[model samples]
Target: MITILMGSIAIGLSLGVLGSGGSILTVPVLAYGLGQTEKQAIASALLIVGLISSVSSFSGIRQRLVHWPLVWLFGLPGMVGTYLGAWFASFTTGIVQMTVFATVMLAAAWRMFKPSKAAPETRSEPSNWLTGFQGLLVGVLTGFVGVGGGFLIVPALVLLSGLAMRTAVATSLVIIVMNSFIGFLKYQQVLTESQTQLNWHIIMVMTAIGIAGSLTGQRLSGRLPQQKIKSAFSIFLILMAGFILYQSLPALFPAFTL
Candidate 1:
């Protein structure tokens, strides 16, 4: 229990500092630390990520950092995609889900390691069609992997929609909240009684600790050099991805392992 709480706090801190990665960590924490099945971990992660992002978003809303128009354009279609992805996830095997999730972590780490481009001086809103398409793609990934997808959404908003980095980060939180909630609902539709009971226990403890850690992380973000932090985090993700692949592949292909 203590270890799980510590892991949850780490997950929240990642989100607070990077505005991403929390959901990415949550699945592993729940699965390995708490002994949840992949599907159970994914479902629980969606709820935790959604609630944490929603709470974190209030600060952005207060500062007027969020772009409302972008949220509407990107979030509605994302909800639909999230639902579809969650439905598809229900039929997948545990090893298959973990393997896909590890792949996503590798992709995210690669993106993080790349040099960040400067934001455009003159911003223009992305076309509705373009925003919707990106949102749908991100949402599907989020639902499938139980991640918030902020790592993807933040860059898309900056490059595709021409949002400033700050605005993009804030706006991505809103999209994540929408995607996570919808995905969680869909995932929950197939949960067993035992899973529900275990999830409840996990959720209550993790959410409380996670929220507290997020607040602490927000404070630290102001003082820390963000690029250095992101670099370190990217390396951590790469290591985690390797570990996940090593653990999951054997189960996925036992004969090949021999």
Candidate 2:
């Protein structure tokens, strides 16, 4: 419980300060720290991250950072993709899910490590079809792995939709919130059918702590060195991803060894 509480603080801080990494921390916190099954961890992550992102997005709205045209173009498809992905996840096992999740963590780490070549200005407006396709892919990732997919979304927004970094961050929050809620609904249905119960006490406690941490992180964002933070955190992500794979792969393949 203490471990999950502490981890939740990290999750909120990452989201608040970086506008990313909430799902990365939330999934592991619930799964490893709290010793939950993959399904439970993912379900709880959707709820926690969705709510935290909803709260964090208000500031983005106040700052007018969101691009509604892009939001509609990208996020609507994302929602549909999320529902489809969650449906697929329901049929998979813990090992398969965690293995895929580890792959995503590595992808996130790679994104963080790469310095931005993206400009703050609009290069071009990608076609609506291309934008929706990107969103669909990201939404599928979110639903299947229980991520907010901000790491994926921000880059896609910048590259495909020509949104600036700050705008992408703000816009990704809205998309994340939408996809997460829908995914959570699916997971909740699964839990009901299986007669499984969530640890609401943990969810409530983590949400409270995460919200507080998020506020503090907002205050610290501009004050902190974002590049340095991301660089160090990327290394941590690599290590964690490797760990997750190491633990899960051998179980999935008896013949495979580290």
Total clashing pairs for each candidate: 0, 0
Looking at model 1, report the run of 10 residues with the lowest lDDT sum: 190-199
Clashing pairs in 2: none
For model 2, give the RMSD to the true fold.
Answer: 1.3
Task: Please write out the lDDT profile of model 1 over residues 1-258, one tens digit for every residue.
Answer: 787778889977887777888888999989888888888899999999899888878878889999999898889888988988888888788789899999999998988887777767777766789889988988898888898898899988888888877788788888999999999888878576235544687797898888888878877877888887788888998999988998998899886562
**Model 2 misplacement above 4 A:** 120-122
lDDT of each: 0.85, 0.89
Query: Across residues 20-107, which tens digit of lDDT does each residue of candidate 2 receive?
Result: 8999989988888889999999999999999999998999899999998888888999999988999999999989999999999998
Q: Tell me each candidate's TM-score.
A: 0.94, 0.96
Instruction: Please give the lDDT score at residue 149 for candidate 2.
Output: 91
Name the lDDT value of residue 60 in candidate 1: 83
Residue 169 of model 1: what lDDT?
A: 79
